[model samples]
Target: MLNSSFDTASPSSMSNMSGRWDFGGEKEPLMHRIHAYPAKFPAFITQKAVAHARERGVEVKRIADVFCGCGTTALEAKRLNTDFWGCDINPVATLIARVKRNDYQKTRLEHYLADILRSYARRHRLHYSPYLKDDRLNYWFDEGTILELSRVKAAIDTVPEGKYHDFFLCAFSNILKPTSKWLTKSIKPQVDPDKKPVDVLPAFEGQVALMIKALNEVSEQPGKPTKKAASIIVTGNILEMDFAEPMVDLIVTSPPYVTSYEYADLHQLSSLWLGYTDDYRKLRTGTMGSLYHDSDFNRDIKNLNATGYGIVFQLYDVDRRKAKATARYFADLLKTVRQCVKLLNPGGMLLFVIGNTEYKGVKIDNADYLLSCLVDEGFCEIESTKRAISSKILTPYRDARGKFTTDTTSRKVYAEEFVVTGRC
Candidate 1:
């Protein structure tokens, strides 16, 4: 059961919010970059949002990230010594988050690292018979490279129950994209038609080395994140979580950008290695549908009331470079907001780190739409800040003429993250 003290009703009188403030900051290194993710909001964005919640006298004893990609929100929460929990449909991502937030004994980590290395030295020279008949594999890597990756997977699968199992699994997950033919430019698994990719074997070994170094640096830090009191990563869809009533204190999350990138296909290599999905086409169902679909806004409307979670959207599909139909978009967005409200502990605050998207040459005012959802749902607006999208690492494209493009027609997104809060 959730604590009752934090579940009080909202203050009767509240102010209607109209504008935004500047909240630009730097990104966190080490973990967020363990592997590339196309549009992960910076750690600084989450940190500042979390800090803003603290200033309002909101007793954020526990934080929940519904779409806990790469574990940014949970990790920052752990660093601050706050109890944290999160869920995601992607198993590989959940695995990485679980490993990053694991409470490992320093001595045990050293022992586990040494054992994996020793095992690799003995069996690293062996070869593996390819299990999946993915022709794309040959296009991206040579025989030697694939065999080595097989060996790495074999070592982890064969390990006995120990503290390093999750750690080892994380090390394996980190190498998925880096060792593939995909460009490091986007977190998606994009095959560059212009260039022949590197062999997987050498890339696999290199990523393993980098993983070890990152773990070493983390181990050396003064105070590391131990495990959370309660941790969970649901493979089931977030829309289908089996819960009744508001059960969380704080909600921190960044849902997939409106029809921008396919999280599943981008990480397909990991899915293949981990034995999750064999068909790449299957990944689309888990992602926000793209603009090219024949149904367009109609498809979203079908999913709106079905989701049961409140997520407001004023987004332009950058792929087609146009704003989505507002009725269908807001309906789904309202459902997401409603889910957030139902999941909250009465007056619990919800934090959204969303950005504006340009669609069909028009900006979809997502922040304003979110505020409207709060008002309709019987929630009170707390505060908000808009930050210039300054972090260039996540932005990685230039038009044919070498100019920065803002329209969504060519799949371009300019940085403009917004922070919004409201009591449920």
Candidate 2:
């Protein structure tokens, strides 16, 4: 129930942000906070989007989130009794998204915990040969910490493959950063020489305790929506997904910021430990705005709309590398919009919770770019609105770690974001 703090944007505001997108559920569910996710929008946005669709006479029987970062929309869809289909390139995201949606049996959770504890105590098979060879793991984790996490992983595997196994694996995956040298509360990946790694068993148990509380809260909490529909979360690049037929009644999602965060780097600990990839850098492939992709900028620049080209053209003079990435991002969004149209039933709605970012004094107006995309794709009834991200520019600056600060020397993050919607 995270608050949107919705209020009507002033009539003269250039963005013309409608106040309707501002109203939503006021508190966040405990289930949604089980894992840390970069750029996950407030869960209530899903509720608000659903309500918006219903108000427009769209009966949302099925919903989809093309870029379902950490499954915020998926869980809310289940609570609202609408079937959900979601996909993310990062497996770490899909794992948490899948786990967050299930209402597991308390007894089974306890049973698995007790078994894992006993197996962990025995401490056999602690030394995994791969640990010695993996440079990335060695850089982050000490030898002792690796052995302890290995035992926890092995014990978690003792649970047969299913939601229960995934649940434990998700727990194990979260503990990797705390038990390693990775800096705390920092979005950037760096080793904190001062960080004394927390003991594995205590951290794992604490996480489990927190998860149990979340489960209890979901089951006993009054006003918690009943689960009436199932959620399907997939791990794959959305750009390559083939939609053979229109399947969803509505699409509600927030697209990733162009080159703002490298999801693969952010989730390296989980991806590596969970065996998602041998080299975490490889996960960058096909990721939106990733500089690593092979993009022919000269040829692809034609796909951009005026808003898109203007932003890229501005950046090209100062930074050629970033300009290429930005152009590719624009092209991808254009294609993504067309693909989204393919997934929607005729007259279905596409609602996006997106924001704009600035780089080197140049504005990257993502909202406007997307609005143009919706138009190019021929989505009718297009609408756009603005919402506040924080106290209006009270702490407009972000420190090196991506935390908000009032200091003018730091990077500026706009206090406002846009909510753009259209009907296909």
Candidate 3:
């Protein structure tokens, strides 16, 4: 609340955010890293959020991540021996989240792996699926690579429809980036011309081995969840979901960014190969902060809250497109907050791990906007602090096109994000 206005403060240019709320205990579990996701916060934040809530006398029975990207909260809730309910708009995200939440028997995984290997061995790629003709797939995958990947997908499909089947598909999905012409560790997908990728079968085998190791690590832990600790993960926008009752005790999540990475674009490879969609852009529909919305700003501007209207008005002076996107993001998240309030039990806490961004020098104060929204919803005990993000796979910078990059010349991503908590 700088100068009684959020726009008064400039965006942080430092590599570290305030260095205040950056806290994590012990090493992160292997399962959290089995798949790469855009803007996945450190796993320990879930632990810290739960602890903070409990310390404040909130008895957390079931945890929830409304925007559950890669199931960090779901996995940590199981580790804490609690129930979980999460949802996401992206099928690719829910796939990884579901796989991470369930416990798999090593014997079953090994048995399925053996059969998949045999199936892959016997598979002769004499024929291709008609979907193989997708131009995007051809642009990112070599001919041989896509053929072998399709065969692997076919073999995994033979494992019957259940967690194991999803497990094998997830294994295949993680290997997609490494085994394709898609450039390594890039948010923006593009073909790597001089690269030679690994064969699909061995990569799948290694992925399963790593997953097995992760499972073993969890199985060996003492305080792991019992069968009663159910995890309910669904695929849909939270804004569109029906919440007739308060189901969650504590909500810990990093909401979607404003005009940032399009998740559908990032997961195009996995989304295509898994048959979730032929055109990934369709996945971006109704997603919060997505640039593609069939909306009339003039019609929508009447409903904008004070914080939203302020920022969007400033952004409109610079760039109308960004202003529209920002307006949409604010409206969606405000509605999302109302939904979150409905989902949380009375006295339950909602902890939002959000950050601020800039567009053409106009500040996009997501944290401030969320703070205001929460207050409007009659939340109490609200507090916020900056949390420094530290990880090898992360860089606090993005190019003009919103692709993650290390170029200092690009717009600097907040080295730290705000953890804003309020009790419903």
Clashing pairs in 2: 1-27, 1-28, 1-29, 2-27, 2-28, 17-386
Judged by TM-score relative to the true structure, which candidate is superior, 1 or 3? 3
State the C-alpha lDDT per candidate: 0.60, 0.83, 0.83
lDDT of 2 at 193: 98
TM-score, candidate number 1: 0.77
Tens digits of lDDT, candidate 2, 257-375: 87777889999999998899999999999898776778899877988878789899998987788789989999988888988999999989999888887766777788888877887
Task: Look at candidate 3 and give me any clashing residue pairs.
Answer: none
Q: Is candidate 1 or candidate 3 better by lDDT?
A: 3
Off by over 4 Å in 3: 1-20, 125-127, 224-227, 391-397, 403-410
Give the C-alpha miss distance for residue 172 in model 3, angstroms: 0.6
Off by over 4 Å in 1: 1-29, 118-128, 161-163, 193-229, 289-330, 393-412
Which stretches of model 2 miss by more than 4 angstroms? 1-14, 17-19, 124-129, 221-227, 391-411
Question: How far out, in Å, is residue 33 in model 1?
Answer: 3.1
lDDT of 3 by residue, 1-424 (tens): 2212223343332113455468676888999988889988888889988888998899999999999989999999988889999999999999999999998989999999999888988888546765468898888887777788878887888999999999988888899999888777776666778888888778888998999999899889876444658889999999899998999999999998977878888899899889898799899898887788876787667777887899999989888898898888888888889999999999999999998876656668888888788778888777767776665347766787556776865555676578888898
Question: What lDDT does candidate 1 reach at residue 288?
Answer: 44
Error of 2 at 413 (Å): 2.3
Q: After superposition, how far is residue 330 of candidate 3 from its true place, in Å?
A: 0.4
